[model samples]
Target chain A: MAETPVRFGILGCANIARKVSRAILIAPNSTISAIGSRSLEKASKFASDNGFPASAKVYGSYDAVLDDPDVDAAYVPLPTSLHLKWAILAAEKKKHVLLEKPVALNVSELDAILQACESNGVQFMDATMWMHHPRTAKMREFLSDGNRFGKLKSINSSFTYEPGLEFLQNDIRVKPDLDALGALGDTGWYCIRAILWAVDYELPKTVTALREPEFNEAGVILSCGSSLRWEDGKVATFYCSFLTNLSMDITALGTKGNLRLHDFVIPFQENVAPFYVASNSRFVELSIGCEPSPSEHAVTTDLPQEALMVREFAGLVGAIKGRFKA
Target chain B: MAETPVRFGILGCANIARKVSRAILIAPNSTISAIGSRSLEKASKFASDNGFPASAKVYGSYDAVLDDPDVDAAYVPLPTSLHLKWAILAAEKKKHVLLEKPVALNVSELDAILQACESNGVQFMDATMWMHHPRTAKMREFLSDGNRFGKLKSINSSFTYEPGLEFLQNDIRVKPDLDALGALGDTGWYCIRAILWAVDYELPKTVTALREPEFNEAGVILSCGSSLRWEDGKVATFYCSFLTNLSMDITALGTKGNLRLHDFVIPFQENVAPFYVASNSRFVELSIGCEPSPSEHAVTTDLPQEALMVREFAGLVGAIKGRFKA
Candidate 1:
């Protein structure tokens, strides 16, 4: 018997779609069956440029993508402002979703998306790809081990960069309608999400926001902090900024010792990536390398996001198929 | 002409008074002239045991201590719950005042104390002795030096410890009337103060708070993050906690590199005390000796609060005497 692959469609020719659609094509048990954009010309060009399968279809509008019978799941990489509209429509059409990060502009919007997915009995997952990375799984395991980092006393994480106006002009991410979707939302959200995931999804009780508004026209926060608490009374702090050059790191402290991931925001793909663990008055460095699956081709690519997302989506599909129960 | 020393009378036989009174006796131009406590017996015994001048009088009440003509300044080391009342009384008496940390329970109480001091023209300074320590001065210098850490990005700091029940059972710090005075006020204030000082007191625009109430009966925050922004859009974060065993450290990230101070809560003293600074991608161990002018005491003996209070008070006295311009 031949195993059937999950058919996927791209909703909106978002910059993220270029990345996510590539992952979909390479993902095990998955096929990019359709592509969509606001203009038919754009969709057809993207499909042709990316060498989409001859059998794959092209749609002029996002609604047309959802209406396609061959598309079983949809990757919604629409602009932040349009996430809610398309996500609800996708769920209503009985299509499972792998929605891009921020999921929505705020928690309230995320709740609505959750409700729509649940009510329609369609599987849904936030494409916080880092959460599904094997390194994250290892981090969670190490935290649970208790001997390594001890009870987590505090967390500090940051993701920052200074992308020029030219970069912003070409990137939909810098579009103003996204509510100054500057660093805090674009990159800071990842820092917040990583810390939250490490602490088992403990929501921040109070958030003290500080923003360098001059960096962005929309009065968006250039940097911000979320002071969070776990049920065990542990505290976590998250920080993000877009006003400066690129920096991605997370440091966690505990009673017995501390652990620091030097470049945590970007996962280590090669043998040179360094992580530090300190305990009992001694510090040790560990070299971390990504382990590619046997079924996949190992291309000389710096595509941490692409590789991890494809692997994770394939696993999620398998879990839904009961190959493994969550 | 005989240089007349400023006579200092300390109210309350608090542990902090012992350090302040000693500093006063040994200060270049000061004397431990008198002592006072709620109980006359405790006041008299403390005076005799500590070797106050024969002319120094013991007072049964705080008001009596303030009334003494020999008492040029009064050191108020009462409980956290009573800082405001004593500070106000001292300010009203036209006495130079050196009040202990938190200055007051909240900004309102601190404002009242500041107003009283401003109106009376009495020199008032919070006894945050660490600020006077050479290590802090050095940290600030390193942070501001463009050749060193460069533009400040983020700050991560924590001070926590597991104290015995007796340490807090009857302590006013754990009392409900004082309102969240445990970690946030006690150790956490140091973290807040350091961050503010590091960023040159750039006030935060918005504050989000998360607290662990179980750690203190008064709902004192076990940990908190104060996100701040400056006029130029610099961002900073401060974290403090008291639930776990002691771990006091500060990590500051900058454009070129970062600096990490291990055991920041304690002074970097001689052979017995050491601190590590990570800068220029190398860890340097700092061995700091005790202040030479005071005595040949171990650097560890120099509590930040004690050193800072003494130095500031000495400067204030000089300013008031017209020997030094303010």
Candidate 2:
């Protein structure tokens, strides 16, 4: 018998939802079943704008979509302030949840969402889509190789882009009421995640925020950086901003090797991504230069990374449904 | 008449001098006139081992190299402790000095040498050979590009190498009475210079050394890092150590582009050097990836960077001589 794909119901019509909606349509194990907005016409327009199937339902309110029996999972692209209410309610309705990044205002809110999902017996995952990139796993393999990479000595990452003055003054990310953490929660989150990812999720023992983090009038961070140190003498630093040119980078150095990639958050091309690796690197004779140049590794995938993320999440949902039937 | 070449007298038979001696030989307008060590036999062995010309003189004491009238300039490669004495003496003796890096034990010592050189009317330049690489000039051109690489925002550099335990415990760098700054003066100097170079030689307004610098039993730093902040909000960080695998990197981010090179202190190859550049980089639609990949730029030179440094230094000496005769 053919397995039924997990049915997705998007709870908000935010810009990111358009991308995720396309992901759901492309992921083999997922399908867009419904979309809801405060305005019925806008929800219908979003469905067509993002190429949702003609059979997909359009609803005037979020409650109508969650109330339907076919929405096996809810993709919440709502602002941070709305995540706690809608996500917990979606869990109460027994729908699995795929929450957007900066999942909650703080750990406590995230804990609440996690507890609700646990109590309701549903899956919950934040939409950190890059974690599902095939290139990430390849990079990890190099970092984990003791003979090739040795001990992790240091890492530096930065995620920054100029969003212009209008966004700084009006974007939901900069508005404290909507996303209180501001750039730290948005861009800096990726930088911090990259550092943690490079170090195998090892938490640093101390974190000292570098002096001079820029802030708006409402005290929302516009740019910031921090340095972290581990007990084992490992060190890491990260910078993120809304004031610089578009730049995403991660550089990890170990005792025996180094890894660098510029487009960590998003690859330049959907089909192929490249990373540079240098193992056992050293200077040439007389130290006039180096020997054994760094080699570039390119990873290609047929499906875009976002689609892969959706496929992975929906596969977990499908497995859970199969368990219930059995 | 043919332009007279600059005559160089080398003080000490240090390991680095062997490389510089070859540079002097390869450079068009420079020639090694003499080399001196504490033992005449050792100096003679070094001269023969390094393929010095038959006319090159070998002497028993550093004083003899400075006192020789035929020696138009002195290349001082003595340990830091001896720099204040020998560098000043060479300047007072009217030999245009090519001093080794970490020019003196402190700024005051450097000032005294500079004062002597000014009083004696001879040129003075530290032997920072990477500054003369054709690749360095190319990188500077990119960084100075306003339309391609707007205002500089941040920079990070590191220079590290593992010389093994035998050298760490016994090398002159680890001895407090000798090269007391250890890794800071040895490896860190290059990193600091790279940061300053990226910002057009503008000094940072504030600098705070990162905590927990590893030091030897004799109070010499073995590993350390520092963060510098410019008045205009530009920031930079640098790290150096004698405890990790060989790595040299410099990454500078600007408002319009970024520049990165894995081997900034030394090129990976003597004949050709490369650096990666990304201009006007931006994420593709939906931030799935980036657009316009960073391209590798290779610069080729017939003369090694060290030899180019010698040619530049010698050209200055020759220009001074020409002006005096005119």
- Reference-based lDDT, each prediction: 0.65, 0.89
Per-residue lDDT tens digits for candidate 2, residues B16-128, read 99899999999989999999999999999999999999999999999999999999999999998899999889988989999998888889989999999999989999989
lDDT of candidate 1 over B1-326, digit per residue (tens):
44457678798997657666766765666787778888999998888777787888888999998888777777888876787898888888877888877778778988998898889878887777667656666667768877546688777676655444675665556666753477678778888877778777877665545553445545655555556656555656666655454456676666544555545555433123333333333211110111111011123334333544575685676567554333
Residue pairs clashing in model 2 are A266-B289, A267-B289, A267-B290, A268-B290
Model 2 misplaced stretches (Cα beyond 4 Å): none
Return the TM-score for each candidate structure.
0.62, 0.97
DockQ of each: 0.09, 0.65
The residue-by-residue lDDT of candidate 2 on A1-326, one tens digit each, is: 66799999999799899889989999988999999999999999999988898889999999999998989999999989999999999999999999998999999999999999999999999999889999999999999998878888888899888777789889999988998888898999999999999888888898888778878899898888888888887788788888777778898888888888888888888998889888777666677776567788999989998999999999899999999999
